[model samples]
Target: MNQRALFAAAAATVLSSALLNMAPAAAQDMGKDMGKEKCYGIAKAGQNDCANLSGSHSCAGQAKTDMSKDEWKYVAKGTCKQMSGLTADEAKMSMTKKM
Candidate 1:
């Protein structure tokens, strides 16, 4: 195969592995005082405030402000898949670069 194609394949393989191994936290916490999807601490970026929990690296590439509520949901879903090493601050800025 060509060099470009080989590099692409390798990158895809690495991405697939990271995604396959990652686990996303739920929208609820064990404590009843916290609101639904709020206690988990993984807010939908600009949708709400969060203390910044651990998550995946791929989330660093997601967009911060979406056009609508539904779009935001998809954005958050993708962001949640990132590894535990990912930080909300890093993700917030990276996704906000476009707007």
Candidate 2:
């Protein structure tokens, strides 16, 4: 192959190899949260981890209010209550009582 073509192929191979090497580390970092627990009422506005309890939105970062009792974020397991957050059931009950 010409020098330019050879250089381009080498760069692509290096980039692909670097990305492949990063994939496992990225996956491992994600797995670190596997033991986390959902802590409701802790997420600030637009900072939730996933869907809200009320089903108003089906995606994360959609909370319109802070500590809404419906929004949640992942906290270390058993640390939810310590952070003054509620479980899904408790948040559901709280919302129910408010309505």
Candidate 3:
């Protein structure tokens, strides 16, 4: 390959390698954040966390119903049970009322 092409290939390879190495480290950093709390029944439809408890799906933004009792999302710790937010029990109650 020409010198310019060789240089571009080398740069791309290095960038790709750096990104691969960073992925796991970024995931670890995310796990270390203990301030997050899982708040159940507060997520709007299509806005829950990574997955539903019932194994219906394994991705966020896939919830079929809003404020579902079994749905949960992580928020700042203690924020979910505040006066404005609903605790897990409270969420279940709200869902029961709507049913």
Candidate with best lDDT: 2
Better candidate number, 1 or 2, judged by lDDT: 2
lDDT of 3 by residue, 18-94 (tens): 87666534533452396776677777898876566556766667889987777777778767777255656776677
Clashing pairs in 1: 55-83, 56-82, 56-83, 57-83
State every prediction's TM-score relative to the real structure.
0.25, 0.66, 0.53
Off by over 4 Å in 2: 1-33
In candidate 1, what are the lDDT values of residues 42-98, reduced to their tens digit?
A: 334554331233222223224254321212122233344452223345455545664
As a TM-score, model 1 comes out at: 0.25
The RMSD (Cα, Å) of candidate 1 is: 13.2
> Which pairs, if any, clash in model 2?
none
Itemize residue pairs with steric clashes in candidate 3: none
Q: In each prediction, how many residue pairs overlap at the backbone (N, C-alpha, C within less than 3 A)? A: 4, 0, 0
